[model samples]
Target chain A: MNIYQYDKSKEWFQRAVKVIPCGVYGHFSPAPYAPVEAYPFFSDKAEGARFWDVDGNEFIDYMCAYGPMVLGYHHPEVEAAFQKQISISDANTVASPRMVELAEFLCEMIPVADWAFFARNGADVTNMAVMVARAATGRDKIIAIKGGYHGTSPWMQAPGHHGTIADDHDHLFRIPWNDLEALDRILAEHGSQIAAFMASPFHHPIFEDNALPADGYWQQVVDKMHENGSVVIVDDVRAGFRLHMGGSNEHYGFKPDMIAFSKAIANGHALSALVGTDDLKVDAAKVFHTGSFWYCAGSFAAALACLNILKAEDGPARMRMLGEKLTGGLRDLASSHGYTMIVSGEPALPYLRLADDETLMLQQAWCGECTRRGAFFTSHHNWFLSTAHTEDDIEKTLQIADEAFKAVKKQFGS
Target chain B: MIDQLKSRLNLKAVLRNLEVLPALDPVSAELISDWNISLRFSVWRDTQVVLDFHDGRCVFHSDSKESTSVNLFFSSPAHLNNMFENQASPLPLKGFTKLGFLKKEFSQLIGRLEYFLKPAAETVQDEAFKKVNLALSLNTAVFAIPELMKLDPVSRRIAPQFSAGSLQFSVDPDGPHAHIIFDGQSRAVAFPGPAVNPTAMTVFKNSEVAQALVAGTLDSFAAVATADIQLRGMIPLIDHSNVILDRLPLYLQ
Candidate 1:
């Protein structure tokens, strides 16, 4: 969808720049990232597989709001749910029944989720999880993998940026992704002092070096954490619901004490949840979890609709098949061009990478080109295929990828 | 500010250098000539912080008896521009005792002053930015994976719980990249994406966890219970990660 020239959005952006501090919430859609002139236009309206800007230009969306619109913008089923909820009355109360309904639905869908807590975004839920873990374990230390994008919270940033952290909070540790020997060596020494080790299985497209786990990784890690009396918190915010109907854990065959999910679960509505096992549920209860607008009924309705849609008519399998096809074709294109490209992750969260140290710059350029070509997705990230992306949509995306791949090869000299 | 407080507390000599900006100017090119900080945002203790009438960067204080003799290092003009454009508060709040620079003491006074000045909405934003940077730089540095993961609140609530005593973190920011030590092993982990860009990573605790995370492993890394590496000993505190990440820009500015 074209957002560049929309009159209302343009007016809104201009008016917002005058008053609002950053004219946006958080980091996702901030100004420097969405420069008004150089970048794509601001969006005005969106539908399945397409969106329109105030300037009246239409484009095929790929970014999916950086992974929220798994069902695509304004999918009929999801939008209908939101509209119906609005008609009933939007509840912005302290704790709405809609939240409870959504929580119950999540518990039913996810295998290990005996109890669930709701929030507006993934960061809110993550913060709550840390607080809960501290209260339960009566510890303050935590473990996480390096390059794992948890969220924008300060705790996550502590282990991220080298010089950004303030002097007072120097507790968060960073570790490389997918290193078993290092994991064992460190945990053995510090197990008694750690509070929790939170991780996401599919960080970006390539798990570790554009590959998956070796074998029995999850079980070993869990056992080690249990032995040390440390808890394992898995952040499946993006991977959840997309991998399987019961959650990604069912596929892995192991379960984490706690799991946080968002994005697709609500299908675009502002909703996220933290689900924990029965024993771990007690730990989650120890923290002070609060939010002002978390219980919005519209988001709850959207979540219920999204979950129902996922379970019915082999929805998960269909999406997976399409994702595979898209990635498979992209892989073929990359190989034929004699350019080494890596495609990692499940079909739902398929990511492609040009095998080179300068991948970031190359990907950034490719993203800009994709925008110029009328696709909202960025190559710096992954391609999120939604139910809205039909067979025809897949073919179109393949064509775009092929052309984009050629341009990438030419620019990067594959 | 806190150095003076320490003096009030019967500590030794305290030296304070508080740089305050004029309050009334609209922060534009036109206001450069008439800019003065005699009142409003300029008042600090008994000194009135003021800007030179000629150049905006030239700062003045009523307490500086030897304004000409004291060779004070002025912030670059471009740096001041960044403060308004980027919402960075470039004001200096340093307090020194006879022994050395009392940076810690200064931090507390700035923090308390920020708290006291929070009610004034117009002035609060700048003060908030300043305090967040100072507090983060002075007292915060997180070194735990769980704390990093706790950056996401939804995940935080349900994340595995561990004892602080059981986790250990060793971080060194001496090179182009910062190295984190956990599980008693230190390996260099590249910075995720960029300074402010969101990024993530997942590490395996053992062979089994590694296998589960490799190839087409679609299952949760911790799904199949197996013997794996244990976690222990996280450093500093969790709530202070923001200070570390936010304070970096302050130094550059």
Candidate 2:
């Protein structure tokens, strides 16, 4: 096996830092990449389930652009729909019919959606969801899971994060994930002041094992929120289409009053949505939320085509099958190398770590080696599987992972 | 909140660095070599830190003892802070015999420290001077986090969020390193050198990167993106620590 070098990637990054803040800010920043030398800093191009770094190293990408490239990079049906819509009309003075069509499709597809609202990113819709919840209940407080990430809004960011003040979290209360007793306690004290309880369908916090909701956790949470006259919001932005066609809530056998969807929604297009029950439709509209480019039609067409293809091809099941095979193979490979790989969360979106090292240094080194060997794996974040990943890709990834495990063993010990 | 944190930082983090001045600088070592005395700085009803000089070295302690040495008292945190800022003077309550030593050798030692901490443009061009400055700066930055976490409103709120573990910050290849250990109960203890089995780590690629980051001449986020700095392990701990680090310049400057 040949090792990869990133001279060109490094050069581009050197240039980028002069012009761009953090070179590639947000989730794409290389700050979290352990042994940063082993990872490429820039990409040249991407296709189905693979991308070529600026250094010309090809990788079997498992991150899927951190959950945006769902069906795959440059998915044929989605691109064609976007192109057709743009060639006729996209951003126009009068909104295109595609907007209505996409909303209708979403309302029909999602179990809880009676109406759909559009936005440009997950944060836009999530911020709107909070406003709508407060408007409906006339309350000032919200309860959320401790580590649940909604978006980068100041209110959503943890207290003491850069540019955030202590009062930013004044009305927000956090409870541990799946702790029903904590919920009961909070409701007992601040029930009337609580407007919403928002969280992801499953816990996928970084640098820790992902957790699924307890057997009756969501159902009980929903019932309790209703009794308190507050609404339930499922921030399904990251795990939306990958879990279930309707919503991740549907997969968990519970429903939320609103489901915020993004990431895989338009198969990499810049679009997000907040769909809510009819009871909150008036409140949602009255919140007075709008973005300049929210009426763009090309992404709506792309989303309609993408969702239709996902429904036809059973994209979630396909991703789950692929994820299972990949994780199982990786686990066996770890065992063979005298290591224990703890895999958690749903099969479709798996977070892997090495049980051999609690500090995660070993896992980080393994991930770095795998990334350098052409399987783009991040140690801390959950890996996303897409319908474009075939069995061959999985096999190749396992081979790379095997080599990575060997490299880690050679560096550390058995 | 700012004044209280600044005062604690002045005593615990800033003044505490005096313990290392002898090892890092020959002048300071010589000045303190013949001295056998403990100097205590007390803010009324608040905090007291003692610096003991003996055997060509200095050591810091949080607890006070009934030793025959020197004691400087301040009426409040603001009074202590004003002394650090050179706007006021401490009222010596004991050891009138050592006042000459304090005025001459001790004052010169403090001058040397101030020279390193607030270096002139030409002095910083010297490689050796730059190295000592970077080390002291790193020490001050790491030591101040615990004080801020205990005193600053925003940092106090963030302290409990840290998982109980040690976070190591290091400059690569034989440069300085420091550790901050969180007990998961809003208390943190900071010390010099690498931590064993740290829960998280932030490493600068070399002395150049470390100096740039510590001096605030380089953007940290840009450095991370360019791999001049690397972060690993439990990232939330590192992230929360960085947030506290962000406020360091406000007090340090």
Candidate 3:
């Protein structure tokens, strides 16, 4: 096999370094996980589960553009709808009727969604959710899970984080994720001041394996928050429409007063829907929320199309099967190679954890080899699967995984 | 720019400074006593520090990793000093009193950082503004944004969330107008040059509004609405001004 080359990518990166700060910083920085010389630095185009880099190398994408390509890259149905909408008018001062159609569809599909508001990203939805909850309860403080990613509002970010100040995080109260006792203590101490409790449907931080709520955890937390008159906000950013036709709250057999949706809602189209119960609708309406391009009709059109396909294809069930297959296969492969792997989170949004490797050195080497062999996934972050990944794609990925594992054995001798 | 996280995070220096570190002012400590503030500073190229502030104490972590709760990210030393020095000046000191959260001792924190950065300049002067801009801009002016991904996956994701053109905060009431421009990508350039033909510019009528905003006194929305402020270009850009202006106090190491 030809060794990976990054000549084109390196040139592009040098240009990017001049203008872009930290040169591909954040989750997009590939130098941390994959070797700088081996990783393809820039992608040229994408379709289905495949994307071509600037160097003309193609790979089966598991990053899924960091959790947006649910139906796949440039999905025909979604793009067709988007193109049709753009041919007409894309954005208007007065929002299009497409919003009404999308909102109505959400209400019909999601059990907790009595009415919905639209935004451009998960951060906007979660930020608005916090405001709506605070407005409804007239409380200053909010309770959230520690290490949860709720979006990029000042309130959600850590103190001293660039672009934000003290007031941003002053109202937040963080408790350990899935810790019932910690939740009780926090509630007992500051329940009245708490306006809302926000969290994703499952645990999916980049550093560790994603975990779900413990048994009966959501129910107890909900009951306690409701008793204290605080609102419940479920952040369905990564798990939106991926776990169930309804909200992930429904799948978990619990409910939230407000839910934030993004990622796969429009099959990679940038859009976020904040749905909430009827009781919170009045307060939600009063918030001063508007964005210049938030009312893009093309994204709504794509969402409408994507929702239809999800229902018709029963996308969640299919995704669950796919996840199970991938998870089982990877686990088996790891065991055969004298390694252990733990798969966490929901069926569709799973996290891979290698057992007993403290520093993730082995994990990094293995994933780097797989990436060189033209497979796209990350050792540090969780991998996302889309409906676009066929059984053959998974089989091929497993074969690549087998060889990659062998390479890891050669390098580290584990 | 939150979703565009790909690989490089220069949060090391800020973390180190916060951890093994600076003597924080009492007011700053009190404000964050109930909150945990994580800061990442990229000092040199690829070198970063991760800092977590809890209960008025700061802890330096082993790695310059990402945190969802990071409220401030400083790309370099100059950026951080600019924020602190701007906040320290007494001219904008009046505006801090107007803010509800900032009213309580936050000025002391700003002043403390200002003192730490400039340290009285060996002689005291009545003209506070002269001292701050001189001290802040003395060592370095602006560092070029390390360009890596402009159209890549993560870069592509965040760029669309903002407007296509540049956004600037025109903060000078004096000559040689200073403005910070967000190039609609990862870079936010602070220019001492003329604020010529800006795509969108938020002009501070005076230094008070500038200090207030930088001191974290003025609620981002209120700063634009204030009588001392004048906005040009798109109105939406003014609304999103916090995307650039709020990052001033951050010294990205």
Best-fitting candidate, measured by TM-score?
Answer: 2
Candidate 1 — which residues are off by over 4 angstroms? A1-38, A92-94, A158-169, A205-211, A356-359, A405-414, B1-253
Error of model 3, residue A400, in angstroms: 0.9
Of 2 and 3, the candidate ahead on TM-score is 2
Better of 1 and 3 by lDDT: 3
Can you rank all candidates by DockQ, best first? 2, 1, 3
Question: At residue A101, what lDDT does model 2 achieve?
Answer: 97
lDDT of 1 by residue, A245-331 (tens): 677767678887888888788778888888887886776766678777777788888989888987884566777888888778767
Which sections of candidate 3 miss by over 4 Å?
A: A31-36, B1-253
DockQ of 3: 0.02
TM-score of 3: 0.63
In model 1 chain A, which range of ten residues has the least summed lDDT?
A29-38
lDDT of 2 by residue, A1-414 (tens): 879999998889888888998887888888788877888978869999999998789999899989989898999889999999999988889888999999999999998999999998999999999999999999999999988899999999878777888789989999999999999999999999999999999999988999999999999999999999999999999999998999999999999999999999999999999999999999998999987899989999999999999999999999999999999999999999999999999889999999998888899999999999999999989999999999999999999999998899998897
TM-score (chain B) for model 2? Answer: 0.95
- Residue A109 of model 3 has an lDDT of 89
Worst 10 residues of 1 chain B by lDDT: B8-17
DockQ for all candidate structures vs. native: 0.02, 0.64, 0.02
Instruction: Point to the candidate with the largest lDDT.
Output: 2
